[model samples]
Structures are given as C-alpha cells and as structure tokens.
Target: MNDALEIDDLTLWLGMLEKVVDGSTNMVVVTDRERRIKWVNATYSRVTGWSLPECIGKRPRELLHGPQTSAEELSRLASLIRQGQSVSNFELVNHKKSGEPYHVALNIEPIRDAHGEVCAYLSIQSDITERRQQERHTVELKQRLEVAQRLARLGRIDTEVETGRPRWSSEVFRILGMVPDEAPREFEGLLAFTVPEDVSDLRRSLADGVEAGEELDVEFRVIGRHGQQRWVRCRGVPACEDGRYTLPRSWSVQDITFYKMRLEEKRQRNEELNQLVLARTRKLEESNRALEEFSCALSHDLRSPLRHVAGFAHLIKENLAKGSVDDCLGFCDRIVQAAGRMQNLIEGLLSFSRMGREGLNVERVDLDAMLREVVVGLHDDAGLRNIQWRIAPDLPAIQGDAVLLREVWINLLDNALKYTGHRDISEVEIGWHPHPDGPVFFVRDNGIGFDPEHAQKLFGMFQRLHSEPQFKGDGIGLALVRRIVESHGGRIWATSKLNQGATFYFLLPNIADSAMPSDWGAVESVHAIGCRCGDSQAVEPGLQS
Candidate 1:
C-alpha cells in the first residue's frame, strides 16, 4: 500500500507540471544530455508546427534546423552545454515545420538528476522579429540625421557642465580640419581655437548662459587650420538640475562663412559704385562749366582779333591799288601774324578738348614701328634743335587706338625736342620693360626738369611748370596723354629732379592675361589714386600759355 501511494503522488505532480508548461506562451522543450528531445510542451508543437510523435525520438537540431543553419553555432552551443553552463537571451533563426523562417530569443538551462549528473536541457523561446526590426529602424534614422546635419554645415557639441569635459561630433571635427582624437578635451582647450578677438566675448556669453540656465544664441569667428577665418553661429540650451547645471547639455554650430562674405562684398561694391557715380557727376558738371567759359572766350577774345586782321588786310589791298605808303603795308603784316597765332591757339584748344570726349578704336599696334615714325617726324620739324633720340629695338605690340596712341607719341616726342632746344645735345630715350604684373612704358628726357613737389600737377589739364618765355607750349599735351592711357585701362606718373631730367612712366594692366602675385600689390596702389586719368584738381583751370 505504501508503494502505490508514492507512485500515485508522483503521477499527480508530473501532470500538474505538464499542465503549467503547456499553458505558457513561451515554447518549452526538454532535451537529453546528448541533445535528443525528451519532452516537449503543447506550446512547442503550436509554435514550431511539429507534433509530439514526430519530435519524440529526434535530436533538437534535426527538428529545428536544416542545412541553412550555421554549423559553427551548433558546435559552440554543444561545447557550452556539455560544460554544465547555460546561455540565456541568445538569438537564433530556425525553420518551422512549414519551412517558414522565424527569429527567436532563446533561453537554455541545464537540468540535473539527483546524482548531480546532467540529464536534460530546458529551453524557452520567444518571437522577437518585430522588436529587432524596430531597433534597426532607429539606427538607420540616426545615421540619416547625421548626414542631414553635415549637409547643412552644422555640427553638435556636448560638454559636461560640472567637469568641463567637451565632446564634438564628427562634423565639428571636419569643419575645424581636425580629427576627433586630435581635438581638445576640455572646454578651455576648445575655446582656444576661437580667434583671440572673439574668445573673450564667447566666454562671457557662455558663462552668462551657464550661470543663469538660459539659452544662448551667439555668433563668433574662428581661425581654421589653413589660416582662413570663418564665421560661425552657435545656439545652446542648458540642462539644469536644482538651480545648478549638470551634464548633458548640447549646442549646434553652423558655418556662416558664405553669408558673411556675401554681405561684406555687397557693402563694399555699393560704396565703390556710389563713389564712381559721384565722381562722374562732378566731372560732367565741370566739363559743362568749362565749355560755357570756352564759348564766351571764343566769341569775344578770338573773334575780335580775326575781325581786325580781315579788316586790315582788305585795307592794305585797297591802299596798294591806290598807291598807299610802306607804313600801311607793315601794319597789315602785324595784323595777319597776330591773327595767325590766335588761330593756332584756338585750334590747339579744340584738339585738347576733343581728346577726352572721343572714344578710341582699339587694335594691336607695333609700338616699335609707331615710335620710329614719331621720331622721324620730330627729326624733320624745324624747331627740334640738335635732339638725340633713342628708341628700343623689337618693342612688343600693344592693344590700343592707333590714331590716339600716335597722337600720344607725337605730343611726348615733341615736348622732349621743344623743351630741350637750348641744351647742347638734347637726349630722349623711349623704351618699355616687362613687369611681373604687366608692361611699363617710359619716356625719359635730359631737359630742364622741374621741382619734385610739382610732379603731382604734371599731367593735369592746362598745368604748366615752366614760364611762357622759357618753354612755349599750349600745356595740353600731357593731359591728353593721360586721358588716352587711362581710357585704355592704364596708369601714368612722372618722376623728375630739377635741372637734371624727367622720366614719365605708365603701366598697362593685365586685362586678358594671367595676373601674378606682383599684380596684387600694384593693383592696390593703383586703386589708391582718387582720379582715374588727369589730376582731379587740374581739370577746372584753363590751359596755361
């Protein structure tokens, strides 16, 4: 009777355990030490679509995995289980009875007998496909967000409030031309990268925000590794804890280099254009006033002399026909000569005025040939008086108006010859040299030079350095040369020492050629001049005699 009661109580306990295992949602299976299935719950059959009869005498591998399962994983699992160890929450893929793949989170535990010998293995598996998919989606979204930030020229930085530790994103390191490992570790170290002019302001702003727990929006400049400065705008939000800021605060910095550059360029261009327009308006008003004065001078001063010459010449012809004396003949000759001088002066003035108003027809001209012709013409002139001329060989061709440029050469060569008429052997040298930026052409003369202080007025309209008796010129030649050279985008200046010599130099910019580093410095100097061609102050006065 005692043996029967023991067997019956054991049956009742086994039945209750089986009922609990079958009703659970997790699939449970028991395997022998050799990994052969010994017992399986009803939930296992429902989940795997395999009945007890089919799985009873089979190993777990045969019932769960086919050729697609990893042999290495199977070897590892067996090795662990034989050592009396268990693995929990391990992931695996297995095929159901219908050949459909399912992902599971598996937990395997060792079952031991009373003699402390491992007899079976208990495994519980739960479906985890949806959970794994959600995790993957979260990771993909984070990667996309980082990409968007990089495209926007933005970066994020985090700092520990208490320890002053700093961390920068990959984009931040890229913007600063630094690697993450090479970046600064502390907030002060990072702030050192900011330009010295901006560092104090940045520190003040950041401190204010941290102390008061307020949000910050600040713009500052930083010198990058390439020595190029860039502008950045940073916005930060502080995380507070009990009136004190702790860790986990972040700020976003965006590169505003392009925006700042555009604004500065626009402002500069507007100012330049405004100045140009104002200067042009002033020039037009002066020209109009000069024209009015010339009209009045022409009608009164010039016409009176012409009328006297014409009236006297007719009287001389009539007196000759009526046997007039020698006195009448001498008076006629004086009137005619005075009128001729007036005519010459009027014509010269008209030509000078027309030079600035006319447009040039630009073309490539052989400067050597042009200078040869000018020298030949000066040699033939009656007033050229023992002049010695030197012209360079193989001078390069220049893009200019032939007619206008010829006029320039004529005026310069004529001045050299006429001014040095009193000298024993008047020397004039005309040549060109190639500069790193462009070409520099010069005309030097050993003549009666003027004071260096008056060099600024040499190229002004109607400016005369010499007295009328000493150098008899209309004083419009140099001004005309200036207008012509400047109209072709060139510059002109004179260097002289009194009683020694004078050298007039001019530069043509590289309009269709590559600019060198030397060009930058020269261009800076060129822009410093307020006037484009002739002296701004000299345009108002009438031409000196």
Candidate 2:
C-alpha cells in the first residue's frame, strides 16, 4: 500500500512538470547526442509548425535550416557541438515548416551525466526577429542623423560639471585635428586645439555659465594641429538640473569658416566699388573739361573756313567787274577751294561720330587680303600710280572686325599715297614684326614727314600741323585710324623725323593662326597730326617679316 501511494505522488509531480513546460510561451527542444530531436514542447510545435511526432527523430538543422542558412555558421555550430560545448544565444537563420524564414536567438546547453560526459542538449529559442529588425532600423536612423549633422558642419561638445571634464564628437576632432581616443577630455584639453589667447575667455565663459546656470554662447577660433585656422560657434543647451552642479551640459558646435570668408569677400568688394566710384567721378570731371575745349576748336576752326569762302566770293564778284575771262575764272576757283575745305571738315566730323557707334565683329582677318582690297579701292585714285608698293610676302593674319580693319588699311594706305605724291620715285612698305603681345603690322612711306616735336598733338580731331594748301586734309584721317585701331583692341603710333618718311606701326589681337600666347594688355590711345606727303632723306625700307 505504501509503494502505491509513492507511485501516485511521482505521477502527480511528473504531470505538473509537463504542464509547466507546455504552459510557457518559450520554445524548448531536447536533442540526443547526435543532435536528433528527442522531445519538444507544445510551444516549439506552435513556433516551428512541426509536431513532436514529425521532428522526434530529426536534427534541429534538418527541421529549421535550409539553403538560405549560412554554411560557415552551420559549420561553426557543428564544430562547437562536436566538441561537447554549449552554444549560448547563437544567432542562426531558421525556416518554419511553412517555408518562411525567421531569425532566432538560440541558446543550447549540453546535458551532462554524473561523470560530466555529454549526453543530451537542451535548447531555448526566443522569437528575436522583431528585435533584430528593430536594431537595423535604429542603425539606419543613426546613419541619417550623422549625415545631416555633417552637412551642417555641426558637432557637439559635452562637459561634466562634477569632473569639470569635456567630451568632443568625432567632427570636433576633424576641426581641431586630434585623434579621438587620445583627445583631451578636460578643460585643459581644449587649450591644445584653441588659440592660446582665446583659452582664458572660453574658460571664463564656461565657468560663469556653469556657476550662474546661464546657457553658454560664444564664438572661438581653433588652430588645428597642422596650424590651419578655423572658426566655430558654440551655443549651450540647458543642463536642466535641479540645483545640481554635477549634471552634465552640452554645447552645439558648428564650423562658421565659410560664413566668415563670405563676410570678408563682401568687405573687399565694397572697397573696390568705392574706388571705382571715385575713378568714374574723376573721369566725368575730365570729360567736362574736354567738352569746353571742343567748343573752342569748333568756333575757331569752322569760322575760319567759312570766312575764307565768304571773302573769296566777295572778292571774285569785285574782280569780275574789272577783269578778263581768265582772271574771273581763277578767282572763282579760289572760292570753290574754300568751300571744299569746309566740306572736308564737315565730312571728318561725320566719319568720327559714325565710327564711335559702329558695331565690332571680331574674327580672324586675312590682313593680306584686307590690304589688297584697300589697294584695289585706291587703284582708281589718280595719284597711286607714282607710289611703288612693297608688301611683305606671307603676311600673318590678325583678329579684328573685317569692316573696321579694312577701313584702317584704307586710311593708312591712302595717307601713304598722298604723302608720297610729291616723290618722283616713292616707295611704301607694308610688313609685320612679331611682338610679345601680338604681331605689329606697319605701313612705312618715303614722303614729306613733319617735325617729331609736334607728334604729341597729332591725333586730336581738327589739329592740323601743315596748311591745307601743303597737304589737302582736314587733320581727321590719322585720328580716324587711331580710333579704329583702338576699337580693334590695338595700339598705333608713328615714328618720324623732319623730312624723313614716317612709319606707322600697329598691333591687333590674335584670335587664331599661331601657338603664341595672347597676353592682353591695355591699349593706349594715339593720334596723328597732319598727314602731308613731302620729302626729306629716305631711310632704307629694311622691312622685317
């Protein structure tokens, strides 16, 4: 009877243990030495969708692992188990009987007998799929936050009131050029990165703020390890401690180098603008002065020619009453000449004004062809026949407006023809010499040249050196030529001596045709006085290509 009572108690205890295992939500599985599932709780069946009857003789890997399981992980697990070791919280890829994959935190313990010999293995598995997914989501959020902070050139600074210690983010290390693991973690540590002069103010600011519970806000400069300077702003966040100075507080740090640089640029630009305004003001003042001079020239020069025409007309009418037919015709010719002189000055004014408004089209101009065209146009002039032309071969091309350049050639060449009109054997040379900035093309003539002393006043409009009778011009042609050369981004100047023929040299910008570097410099304005073709001594037209 005692044995039966004992047996009934044993049955009751075993039944209670089974109920405890089955009631829990955790999955429990027992495997024999070969890792074959010997027993499994109801929870395991629910989680894995496999009944104990089906998995009883199967290994956990055979029931849960498939192709998606990492082979290396499986091999590691197998090696550990074969060594009679316990695998605690070993992460593994598992599949349910429904063929859906899930991650599980599996803890497997080796059951030992009294001799400590491994006999069986018990495993506890928790559904950690949600936990792992949460971890991945957290990582993504952290990455995005870091990216945002970096783009703003922002970092954080934390200080502990109790320890009087400081902490810097990785970005601060970049600003100060310090290694994070070895970075100073105290107030003194900041002195290494900050300028020595600023350390005291920074320390005072922090001390006062901490003591008074006021948020710290300041800008400071950091001298990196490489001695590069960077500017940063620090704005403190409240510690929010309850009268506890031991709490930690933080300040936001951002690199304001770019902002400072922009401010500096703005100041410089303002300075430049102020100077430009002053220059323009001076130029306007000069223009007013020039306008007054123009008025004087107009009144005197125009009135002189008009008076001559009038006087000649009055004299011709008086002489006609007392003279023969030939004498009357001669007086009539004088009147006509005066009218023609006035007409030339008027035409010069028109040409000068027109060139000011002419549009410029820059291109590679075949100067040889342009000069040839000038020659063709002037060929019809009766005086060009006496002047012999010596044009250099293989003339280099230049960059300038086609129409403007052609006009330049016409004026220069026509001037050459007129100045040499008195020569029985006149020679004109057109050639080029290479210069650092560009090529200088010249038109030289053996003709009556003026005094070099008066060369300075040559290019002004209506400034004539010789009388109209000596050379038939209104002193407008050289001025026009200078204007054209200046328009083409070029320089023009004449070299002459009394009686020696003049050589007018000019340069045009190079847009094409050679490997020479085009160094653009400012072109100075030049002028020619009166262009009269007469004689002195002839210089060898030793022209260079």
Leading candidate by TM-score: 1
Q: What lDDT is obtained when candidate 2 is compared to the true structure? A: 0.72
Clashes counted in candidate 1 amount to 0
lDDT of 2 by residue, 1-545 (tens): 22323433433533554576876787888776688877788988998899989998898888898877889999998888888887888888889999888888878888765456666677888878788889989999878766877788887776655765677767777777766763436434554688879889987876777777666677788898889999988776446656655323566778899999998999999999999999878757645644554575588767887887788777777777777466667767877877787788778777766765566887777777778778767867754366577775556676678887887888888888778788887778776655555677778888887787887567777777677677877777887788788767777777777567778777775646473323222111111111233312112133222
Q: Per-residue lDDT of 88-150 in model 1, one digit per residue for the tens?
A: 887777778987777788799886665566756778888776787788898899788789888
- Listed in order, each prediction's TM-score against the native is 0.56, 0.54
What is each predicted model's overall lDDT from 0 to 1?
Answer: 0.72, 0.72
Clashing pairs in 1: none
**Backbone clash tally (model 2):** 6
